[model samples]
Structure formats: C-alpha cells, structure tokens
Target: MLLKLNPEHLLLIRTHAASTYPEECCGIILGYLANESKTVVEVIPTENAWSGETLEDNKRRRYAIAPEIMLKIQKEARDRSLHIIGIYHSHPDNPAIPSESDRIQAWQEYSYIIVSVPNGKAGELKSWHLDGDRQFQEEEIEIA
Candidate 1:
C-alpha cells in the first residue's frame, strides 16, 4: 500500500520529532483510503501519554495517546468524514523501525509511520502496515 502526505504534513511531523528529542513523538493521521492508497488530510500531534513505574521506562522508548484524546479525535474525524488512516511516531536515536511492542499494540487497519531522529535531527521516514500474520510490512511513502 502507498501512504501519501503533503510536504507540509511531513514538516510538521519532523518538527514535532525534533522538538521532542530523546522522547518519542506520536500523533494521529486523519485521512481517507481510496483504491490502494491512503491520503493524509490532517496530522494531529499528541503527548506521549506513556507512564511507567521508573524513569528508565519513559517517553524515550515509549508513547501512547490517552484513551480520552483518541476518542475525541475519532469523533472529530467522523464529523469531518475522515478516518484514522494511520499513526505516526518518532524513534529517537534509533532507526525508523517498529519495535515488538509496537506490533503488539497495533491494529490491522492503520498504517504506521516511523521517523528516525538521531541526535535531535529528524532523518529517514518510513511507513508500514501489518500483514495477516501480524508482522510489519514496509509501505511506500509518497510526498506531494
């Protein structure tokens, strides 16, 4: 599948990644699916709501959208005739690859975008989708 996004949307995600360096940045992508492509219409950045017991388990390695925030976004998307086509997140100082935890929590219908931020600089961006076996398959990213 293909993931299409405007350059402005790309910039917004990159900027958010850089701003939240050392901690992963996360957001929702609102859009529509047509044929075999997903076209992004809105990019909504959110706080990494992950809270762990120790400082070691922090945003640096994890991220989450609060249930309330997700519900609100879902309602807004429905009103605007858009679906949550995908989700995007940053991997600080790491490659743009999904971790095991990512797979465990992902839904089959949404594309997953990961941006690599090495030393506060946003680098490669990649898209993925879960296969029937629940394994991640890389998707093509088209910037317009």
Candidate 2:
C-alpha cells in the first residue's frame, strides 16, 4: 500500500531525527482520519534509549521499541481506527539505508522508515517493505 506523508509530518520526522543525531531516535507512525486517501496523519516521537556515544556494530546499536510505548501506540491506533503502518528510526552517522541487521529485524508487514543523519544534518529519508519471501524493497515516499 502507498503511504502519503504530509509535509508537516515529514518535517517533524526529519527535525526530531536530526536533533537526536549520533544516537538513534524512534517513533510511531499514525494515520489520518476522514481523508479520502487515508495517508499518514502524524509521526509521533517517543522516548528512546541512546546507544551511547560509540558507534557500535549494527547488532549492538539496533533500537528496541519499548513495550509500553508500543502498547500506547497500539491503543491510539485502535481508537482512531488506524493501523500501526510503520516504525521509524535514525542512523546517526550512516546513510538512510537499512543495515543487514535492520533487514533481519524488520517486520515484514510494516514499513520501516530510516532517517540518515550524517554530520548532524538531516541527510535522507527512505522507506522499505519486505516481500512475501522477506526480501526488502525500497518504497517511494512523497511529501505533500
């Protein structure tokens, strides 16, 4: 399914992701109500544990979605009749591309939005989808 992102929402993701640079930032993907296209409504930034100042291996730096936050997001989505479309995170010094570890850990049914923050600047935003066989495919994101 194609996800349409509002410009404001895009900015929120970019800004927050960049602000937490050198460490990972995470958030929930929320959908809109009463829209014909049913695009993403908002990008909600949540508290995340920083993986320290050192650039560790991918396995070591992977961000874990806190269970309480996950439950909260799920409840919000259900209340609004929206789905938990995706999860987003930042890659402090790397490109907005998924690492092998990311590929292995991503949920096949949800979109994974990666923000690449290189040198404290918002570098790129990329989305991915896992096919039936669990192979990753890059998806296009348009900011409206």
Candidate 3:
C-alpha cells in the first residue's frame, strides 16, 4: 500500500525521533483515505510508558503507549473527521526495521513507520504494513 505522508508530518516525526534519542519515542498518524491512498495530515506524539525498574534500562528497547491516551486520540480524531492511519516509533541506534515486539503488537491494516536514530540523530526511516499472512511488508512512503 502507498502511504503518503505530509512533509510537515514527516518533519515532526523526525524531530520527535531525534529529540527522544536513547529512549524510543512513539506516536500515531492521523489522516483520511482518498481512494486507495492514505493521506497523512497530522501526527500525534505520545510518551513511551515502558518505564524500567532501574534507570539504566528503562525503555531502552521497548515502547508502550497508554491505552487511555490512545482512546482519547481516537475520539479526538473522530470528532475531527480523521482516522488513525498508522503508528510511528523510533529505534534508537538500530536499523529501520521492525522487531519481534513490533510485529507482535501491531494490528492489521495499520502502517507502522520505524525511524532509525543512530547516536541520537535521526537516520533511516521507513514504513510497513502487515500482510494477510501477518508478516511485515514495507510500504512506500511519499513525502509530499
């Protein structure tokens, strides 16, 4: 599927990734459907709630979005006539590839954009979607 994200949204996602270096940052992409293409219009940034017991490893490789916050975002989007089109997260010092945890947590029909942040800087970024077999398939991202 082709996921066309707005240039502004792209910038926001990158900025969020760069700022939240070391710890993974995640958020939702809100947009509307036009024929077969999903047009991204907004980005909703959320906190990484995977707090570790010790400071050394708190959310180093994991990110969890609060259900309450998600529900609230959904409701707000509904009110604005927008829908949740996808999700985005940064992989600090890692490649822009979805991990086992990402696949396990992903739902069907939603794009998952993984941003690679190496050395606290934004690196490669890509998008993916789950196929019928529930395997991740990279989606084409059009930064327009």
Model 2, 33-134: lDDT tens digits are 333233687788986744445556432356767788889889988998888878888888788888887789788767788888888887788888788888
Off by over 4 Å in 2: 32-38, 50-60
- Candidate 2 clashes between residue pairs 3 or more apart in a chain or in different chains: none
Candidate 1 lDDT by residue in tens digits, 1-144: 999999999999999999999999999999999999999999999999999767767899888999999999999999999999989999999999999988998999999999999999999999999999999999999988
Tally clashes: model 3. Answer: 0
Candidate 1's displacement at residue 36, Å, is: 0.9
Off by over 4 Å in 3: 52-58
Q: Global lDDT for candidate 1?
A: 0.95
Question: For residues 12-89, what per-residue lDDT tens digits would candidate 3 score against the true structure?
Answer: 998999999988999999999777678898999999988768765567688888999999999999999999999999
Quote model 3's TM-score: 0.93
lDDT of 3 at 26: 95
Kindly give the number of clashing pairs for every candidate: 0, 0, 0
Per-model TM-score, in order, reads 0.97, 0.85, 0.93
